[model samples]
Target: MKIFNAEKIKELDKLTIEKQQITSLDLMERAALQAFLWLVNHFQDKKTVYHIFCGDGNNGGDGLVIARLLKQNYFDVHVYIVPFNENFSIVFNSNLGRLKECNLEYEVISEATEFPNIGENHIIIDAIFGIGLTRELAGWIQKLIQKINYHQSFKVSIDVPSGLFLDKKTTIAIHSDVVLTFQFPKLAFYLPDNENFIAEIVLLPIDLDVKSIESIPSTYYYTDLNKIKKRYKPISKFSHKGTQGHALLIGGCFGKIGAMVLASQAALRSGCGLATVFVPKCGYEIMQTATPEAMVITDENYHKITNIEFNFQPKAIGIGMGIGQDDETTQAFHHFLKTIPFRW
Candidate 1:
């Protein structure tokens, strides 16, 4: 689940192609097939009209392959090629030729005016740009994306959304309903700055070389259920309450005793053998009433925490929940930190 940058993803693709001895076209076909399969699974109705917007790159090539597959399967598919410039990838041209061979007609959109009028019932597949997009889009292309966004159609972006940068924040990009990304999750998808443009991300694995993926260095990772399962350790049958870890939660003032109650309860639910809460004197009765399982200790002050005192060593300490930034509370917290023993 390592989240790699655009360059690292390209490197992984190159390594995968070299290790598997497959042509780039073969890889493109595999990626397109995965996307096609996803479409088939989600949109089973053959009457569903698909408006696939493709660029003059490999992402467009994937769109072309998907168009051909959908057409062959008797689906209502319409393909439109957005030629932003004269340059085009070889695989893209190859897929375009394959689409022509299937007698499936497609239109080339050169201007913003040439953009199609999409209905709300249609599914818009955006393959106009992928992870390779670095710079901001041109005015006309941005307008095209804006028009796509204006439609109330269910939009699914291929690979990454058009105009979205994997490594940096993007201002203008396709605001997709669902982004069907390949292999690893892009870093931009998880960032708060790009929250408006991103949507439900579905990872589609293309069988990239596993060793090559592991060899690449990445600082970010997307932890899934499989990863958690791998790291999960079952509890020993002979383990008792004392053998399990102890957790200490310290926070809460007069009116904010609920915070400590919830925290202590959460600690116990997380499988901690012992749950203890250190709060102001005013929170002692509330914590005991709300969370009967947790042991509570109260500071000398009633409205706020003036001191944090505990005898037994806790495996983990979680502090500062509802503790207001009062001068006395701040000084007490500082003194507590200074006096606390670090077992590790």
Candidate 2:
């Protein structure tokens, strides 16, 4: 799965609409239908109520379509439109008109209106904001998200969490139990900093243009099992220890030799034919005693590493686990860097 930024995703949507010769309304309906099907499959209990919060943009259009589909399927549905702005998208107006035709219950939230009562029995569908958001949420919008999070209901976000930004650090965001994103996963969803805002993500395919996805350039990507399996090579039956590659693990002060010991052990476990560890003179007996399978080398300094010397070159080098920034150790690191052919 490829991770796309906000602009690239918007471009994908535009190119999809143009190349597929489909109206934006039809595309919104497709995304809404996919979300509805997913909800139906996951929420088997028919008695549960669904409270959908929509905005005045295309994301809100998605919520309106979902509400209509849920009503057709005989599910209890409640729709609320967050009146964040006076202007509304054409597709959103079309969906709102279609929703009103069915006589389903719906309301528009304003300054004078009270927030809806939500409980744990109700599932909250958030469509307030999507990836196009470029500013921080304020006023009642922030309070509304806080209220939604306070309800402790099972929340699902449409396309993205209501207030989360795709490219920057998120300050205020909706706490969702799951996110149903269209097309590709957003870059913010994969970052560790946004883990609290993003939960289990479901990539909802809206049938966007494949050529657009392939043609778009991105610096990030999502890896899967198939991609990882393709990178490994099977070992031959006639292979020998010397034929396999060797690995050198370098790092360790007098009191922190355990770091080097663990690194050498990991190198051996990772199928490196030969594993060697370099430490200070004080750690010589410790490394040799703890790991007899690994070859041990010690620097001339007793308490800290001053230099690294070896008769033969290893296939790969691992450094800087427990190496402290002592003056001697720093010079030794510089010397090692200058001696190695590979760039760090």
Candidate 3:
């Protein structure tokens, strides 16, 4: 799964609709259906009240469809549509027509003068804004989001948290406990700095065209089961000790031999056919005692490592494990880099 910027998402939407021949309406329906499927399967008991906050965009369209579906299931549902400009989205209007056909009650909050009283025990679905949102929240919508945050209800966002940037870090006033993003995981969701706003993220795959999506150039990636499983390979019976490559580890001083020990363990676990470790004279006993499997080489100095010498050919070199960065060590390391026919 490739991670994409906000601009690339628009290109993806265009590719899905234009090149792949998927209509915008179909995407909207499928998106709503997927969200509704989750709601039905997880919260079937109708144990909690549902309040959906919708803006005048496609995100709100999704909320309207969910509102209609939840009403059919006899779930206690309330929808608040924050109307923007003079006109609402066409798809949203279509969903509004359907919700009205079912005679479901919803409040059109056009202004902040009369705010809706929210209950803390209910679940709030934030559909006010999605990835298309660029600027900061303004006027009553900001207050509305603040009120939603203040309510302390379990909030779930569709696609993205309302007022959050899918790529860059935008200062958002609203936060969601869990954001159910569409398709790939957004970059902002993975950032440690964004953990509070995103909290926990769940990816909902909506079946975009594989070929066209691949053609779209993107460096960012969303690593998931599907992407990893597609390229996974299992070991074969014909494999042997020499089939895997040898790995060399350099770095261990008198007091910090444990660092090399941990690294060597990781190398062995990673299926290295052969492993070698270089340490100072005093740390040789420690490394040999801890890991008998590793071939050991002692440095020239007793208290610290000064030089690395080896005869056998190694496929990979793992360095800087416990290497000190003092002036002499730095010069030695620079010399080592120049001595080897390699780039550091």
Candidate 4:
């Protein structure tokens, strides 16, 4: 899956709306429906109470739509509107109107004191903020997030955890057990800096325009089974050992022979036809004993790799597993790179 930044995601959304000839409201409904389906599928118990915290934005609109769907289906649902500011998105107000039409009541939390006590048995759906959040949250809203985080309830965030920025780092955000994001995975979700705020990220496809998604330029991608299957090649029945492929693993110093053994074993296990390891003299016996399936070549040096020599060319070479930074070893590696037939 192509991972897009915030601006690129907006661009993709705009392109999708234009190409599909659907109104933005229609798109929002699609997103809300997807999220609602996921919730219903996972939590089959209609008696379970769901407290949905929403903002005055499209993300909050998603929560409102979900609440309406749940209530209409006889599921117990409670909606809270957490307006970070007085301004409200047009679609949000539209969804709010729809909620009222269904005779479903909602509460607007104006202060931190108005925050309800979420029980551990209940489910909290966080829709207060999405990827568009650009500034750090503070004051009562931050306090509300902290209150939600303190609860042991199963928290599911919509699009992204509240207060999370897609293109930048944020100090405070909703720590969710699951994040049901729309269409593509956000780049911020994978950053180590934001790990504390995120858990299992579920991608909910809203049927955005595929042509537009592919047309958008992106350097990041989330590799899943589908991607792997697309690139996989089947082996022929007539194929032999030499027909597969040759892999060269070059590493291992004095006490790090285990590294080379594991590398060579992995090479063969990954369907490599031939596996070879080049190590120092000390590692020669250890590598041979541990990995009998691999072909081992030893360096002239005793404890380090000062020289690397191989006759036949390998289809791929993996180096620097456990190679130490000795002066001679470094110089030998440089020389070996210079002698390779291929350009770097």
Candidate 5:
């Protein structure tokens, strides 16, 4: 999966509209239909009501389409238009006009209007804002977000939360139970700081142009099993122990020698021809018993590692696991780094 920013997503949508020779309204319908189908499959009972909170942007257009489809399917639905911006997108107005044909009613919420009363049985669909939002939310919009968070209803966000900044840190954002995103997963969705705002994510493809997506440059990427599998190489049947690479792991103190044992075992299991551990004298027996396959070299110090020296060359060396920051240990580590020819 490739992670894209808000601007790239907008560009993809434009390219999709141009290359597919379809109207933006049609694309909006496609996205909404996908979301609607997911909802139907997830909630088989169809007895619960969906209270959709929409903004006056393209995201709101998607919500309007969803609400119309749900109404046509005989499910109870309510649409609340959040009047935060005076200007509306062209597709938004088009969708709003189409709502009249479905015989479904919608309410326009303002600062003075009373918030809708929701219950535990109802679900809240948040389309208040999308990836395009770049500024801090204030005024009635902020208040509305607070009210929505206060409610006990299960919250679902479309694309992203109303106040979140897709490319940077956000001061306020909607805490959704699930996020239904289009095309690709946004970078912010994977960040730990925004985990509360974006709980679980479901990626839905809206049939964007593949050529355009491949051509677009991105700094972030999501790796799956298939991508990782492609990097594996076939080992030659005639290969011997000398042909494989060797790995050395340096770490462990008096009581933390288990860390070195674990690292050495992992290196050996990873197909390395040989694994070696450099630890204090106290860790000699522990490493040997834990990992009999790995070779060990003990330092002169009895309790902690005070020197790092090896005769044979290793393909890779991994350092700093359970190595305490004592004065002698720190000095020894610095001396080792200075003595070795540093290379990644």
Candidate 6:
């Protein structure tokens, strides 16, 4: 599925509104409804206490609606509005009044004086800052997220995590234990470095348009493994070892024969039909004892490589890990590189 940026998101939001013939409030309602539905499916109301923190944007509107719906369902819930600014958007104000009418446990923390103490056992619903957070959590709000992290409680971030940059705005993001994201996953949520930011997350579809969503452009993507699985081509049953390619690895100084062994091991594991390793004579016994599957050739010297007699055409050549920059070894490597020209 396609992920969007902050601008594209607004476009998609307006597109969804126009396409579905619903207002932005309707989108917020379904978003919160779906979030609450997920909560009901995963959690029971009999004894769970929920601490919901909301902002002044539509993200908080969703939180307020969740609070009201939970109350209507007779669940124990507390709503805390982390007041960044007093003037909330119209939908937020509307939901705020509705939550007030239900006499829900709601409080507005305008400053540090009104900050409420959250117990360690509580499930925190962080809506203080959602996907549109374009800047760093600055001043007192930065301190608030740090405090939230210190509590070490089971926290659930609504939409994207409270401080995530939705469309590559800022390079930073807040890590959430569980992110209940809407429609599609966030682009940052799938980054190799972002796994810590998002421990576990699930996409809650609220039905955005496919054509309009594709009309937008983005570089980052949420790599869905199931979708990738459909594109994987398995090995043909008639394939033979010779059909695979060979691999040549050059490395390993006097004492680091294990480097060449590891390279040969990886080459074999990656389905290389044949593998060869070139190292100093000091590593010959080591490689032979450790990995007998590899064919080995040694340079003339005992502890360093002066020259390498390259013969076989390998599909790939891997070099440099534990290879020391000795003069003779360096000369050999330079000669080898110039002898074998590669495109890229």
On lDDT, the leading prediction is 4
Tell me, by TM-score, which candidate is best: 4
Lowest-sum lDDT 10-residue window in model 4: 110-119
> What TM-score, to 2 decimals, does candidate 4 have?
0.93
Model 1 residue pairs with clashes:
none
Tens-digit lDDT string for candidate 5 (1-344):
68888889999999999999999999999999989988888777768799999999999999999999999999999999996677998999999999988888999998898999888879899998988998777678888998998889889888887788888888777899888999888888878888778778887889999999999999899986788899877679998666788888998998999889888878877888888888889999998898988999988997887878788899889998777888888998999888787633
Provide the lDDT at 146 for model 1.
91
Give all TM-scores, in the order shown: 0.89, 0.91, 0.84, 0.93, 0.84, 0.76
lDDT for residue 249 in candidate 2, whole number 0-100: 83
What digit string (tens of lDDT, one per residue) describes model 3 on residues 207-306? 7777767898878876777667788766668987577778989887768889999998899888887889987788788888999888789888887777
Query: In angstroms, how far off is 102's CA in candidate 2?
Result: 2.8
1-344 in candidate 1: lDDT tens per residue?
89998899899999999999999999999999999999999988989999999999888888999999999999988998888767889999999999999899988886635768778899999999988887778788888999898889999999888988887768888898888888989888988988878779999999999999888888988999999999987889998778889998999987898888888888898889998899999998898899988998989999999877888888999999898889999999998888785632
Ranking by lDDT: 4, 1, 2, 5, 3, 6
Worst 10 residues of 2 by lDDT: 335-344
The local distance difference test score of each candidate is 0.89, 0.88, 0.81, 0.90, 0.88, 0.80
C-alpha RMSD of each candidate structure in angstroms: 2.6, 2.4, 3.3, 2.0, 3.5, 4.2
TM-score of 6: 0.76
Report the lDDT tens digits of candidate 4 across residue range 284-340: 889889998899998888899988888888899999989989999999899988878
Off by over 4 Å in 5: 229-246, 252-262, 265-274, 280-286, 289-293, 299-316, 322-344
Model 2 misses residue 176 by how many Å?
0.8
* Runs of candidate 1 exceeding 4 Å displacement: 235-240, 326-344
Give the poorly placed runs of model 4, Cα more than 4 Å off. 342-344
